[model samples]
Target: MKTISQVSIFIENTKGRLANVCGLLGDNNINIKALTIAETPEFGILRVVLNDTEKAKKVLKENGFIAKIAPVVAVEVSDTPGGLAKALKVLADNDINLEYMYGFVEKASEKALMVLKFDNVEKAIDILQKNNVSIVDDKVALGL
Candidate 1:
């Protein structure tokens, strides 16, 4: 629900390319908090919410990977039925449109973190705040 920085890395859709990215990050001590890959026929877009986004981008670019930074929203919601529905409903009611989103469950946790991309980030954050949603900024999201 709060705006955060997301790094998008475009890499070849071939074996070892993903490993190359991971190795590069690991070697530089960059930590990935959340990640999702959108793959097509020839290429893949790796979207990552990281503890060190600028460094990650630098590492990727130095290694010849196409990397860019963008803003996204991260929300922590209850890990139960209708938890997502309620959050989405708030956005829908506020006329906010989500371009895409991804998330993961924390092992042995009762909450899930969802990373959201939207055309209207500030407006979405405001709405989410008023509704009492757990909105996290980039640092907070990475810490989670």
Candidate 2:
């Protein structure tokens, strides 16, 4: 479905909580591809794309962390001004609501990868595809 698996972890807003999660994943040989943190005064949601989603989730859970997998869309846009804007405009025009998004540039390519969460994932993908936007698959997004 051209969707990527993202692991969302519920974490306390305490010192070293972030580091502990990262350390657990790293110690287990799980490589993180991309990540973002949504936080409040009490806690934070750590969203991450990892090379091994299942393994990462298992490791985190075994360590007493709350983690779950969610589907997200990854789009590749030109590494130039307005590239992102043009893609976003397609969604806005089609009445798609963006939940949140994060991006990282490919060091070996002149393209940027955007990880997007939409209220309607399937609809968003269909709309974006019809509009000719490039959607990255799970394998590519995870660097597998």
Candidate 3:
């Protein structure tokens, strides 16, 4: 199954922390393709898809940030009403549980891209493919 490497950074909920992380990556020539932050009262998990996963992880770790990489599925959904629902319905019917999801529009394509985490990635990929859903590979996800 094809997957994208998502870099997640555990950051403090303090001023300049987000900027610091972004600045660090930018300074190192890492391009962020997609990003989302899930925050609590005390801290946040900064999840991002970057052009260079290993390099970004190394850069963040060397800067004293706690970063981890995980495989995630990126799928192309139609850019229309019910598009997301239709794709999700395929997963639902297959009894696949979704952990979380985020999305962004692809400037070069008419479809929107959804990044999803599933309880069973391999099974989810198989089901999605069997149902004719388009899965984006690492290269496409990173814009490479």
Ranking by TM-score: 3, 2, 1
Candidate 2 lDDT over 1-144, as tens digits, reads 599898999999999999999999999999878889999999999999888988887888788998989999999988799999999999999999999999743422468898999879999999999999999897777777
Error (Å) of candidate 2 at residue 140 is 1.3
Answer with 1 or 3, whichever has the higher TM-score: 3
lDDT agreement with native, every candidate: 0.83, 0.88, 0.89
1-144: candidate 3 lDDT, tens digit per residue: 398888999999999999999999999999888789999989999999888999998888898999989999999999899999999999999999999999753432788888999879999999999999999887777778
Q: Cα lDDT for residue 92, model 2? A: 95
Question: Model 1 Cα displacement at 72 (Å)?
Answer: 0.9
User: How far is 123's C-alpha from truth in model 3 (Å)?
Assistant: 0.4
C-alpha lDDT (0 to 100) for residue 35 of candidate 2: 87
Model 1: residues with Cα > 4 Å off, grouped in runs: 104-109
lDDT of 2 at 3: 93
TM-score of 1: 0.90
